[model samples]
Target: MQYPIKKNSLVDETIRTIRQHIRQQTWTLNERIPSEAELVELFGIGRNTIREAIKILAYLGVLDVCQGDGTYVRAVDDFSESIVLLNRASLHDHLETRCLLEIEIARFAARRRNAEDIQNLQALLALREKINPLEDLEEFWIRDRDLHLAIAIASHNQALHATYRYFLSTSYEYTKLFIQDEDLAEPDHPAHETLVAAIISGDENQASAYARALLMPTIQQLEQLSTT
Candidate 1:
């Protein structure tokens, strides 16, 4: 099926349209995105608009398309945008995303991480431990942020590392915005211990799953509070 070219390309508009559809449950991950023909008909946009939108979503890790195979939702839980939202998002959202991303990546890191990466991660973890539990909130968060950065950098993917770096910066500033979230100020969270153990033991699934479990309660707590 051929899609008509638009007189003026609307890449941003196309993207917005796609996002709305996804958010509205019009399409799902692993399901084919609306065809270019459908998009052209509905939006009266050009083929270039459709193509650009597809390409951008693919970059954002939202949708996947194969040359022979149709496009599919990558994962309903895909958090590329979530990571990009690290800055503007709430502290709770930031924590949830970080825990999920790290644990998943940590599992991969356990299997694929090189010695140098391991060393780097270990050093960062150690540095985190040296900070007094009684330290100021700012200092605690600094070390806390460092631990997340270490894991991402240890993954050794330039794109992943860079994405996480930006997330860290945003999260650091945003975390400072709240003074009442004291639980995260703890110097030793058992989840971090499990994370390190899993990485060292080369158990990716264990690592990622543990990381998710560690943060799940906090997410629930946040939800409960938000409702009230």
Candidate 2:
């Protein structure tokens, strides 16, 4: 049966389906593809659709397509390499989800981390402190995301890492959070410091408490923005 592409055009879903086929041995990474013409017949799709799909997989390092030689699957495991291949959702939604994810992940992470994680957390916080809003907001925003991601990665959970990036790419509010507060150039508490500290110090309860304390203010700010 010809499989239909996912609606909403989410590449994650599309890649997931394609990866499933590869995992089921429906497609072999080391073997040659049946050809563009064959893909058209196999999926009952147009040439461009097949081409784009193949390109997506290729971009994920999951396929190899030599000029004049047919496409072949190279790997078919995870698609975390392709989070940037998004077409669905908005920045606000992404920020909302990201904040929520940290709220949960921080709880478990605070209890499961080590000394190195704490060190990295402190370093990121120091870097954030050096941020002068007299410069462009973009650079500051990048550092902010880096610090949060550093803490999330310290959790050592692959799924959380992947999900965290998904939000990072789409969160406009995250970028806006600092710039909106002109007086507060650098983060006062450095949310990641508190997060990483609690995690590395084996205080799961403190991590969650701090996370709520941290995000609750952002939530209020967002609500104010929405109303105004």
Report backbone clashes per prediction.
5, 1
Model 2 CA deviation exceeding 4 Å by range = 1-88, 134-136, 169-174, 181-187, 190-193, 224-228
Give the alpha carbon lDDT tens digit for every residue of 121-154 in model 1.
Answer: 7787777777664457678788877877777766
Give the number of the best model, judged by lDDT: 1
- Per the 3 Å backbone cut-off, how many clashing residue pairs does candidate 1 have? 5
Q: Report the C-alpha displacement of residue 175, candidate 2, in angstroms.
A: 0.5
lDDT of 2 at 52: 78
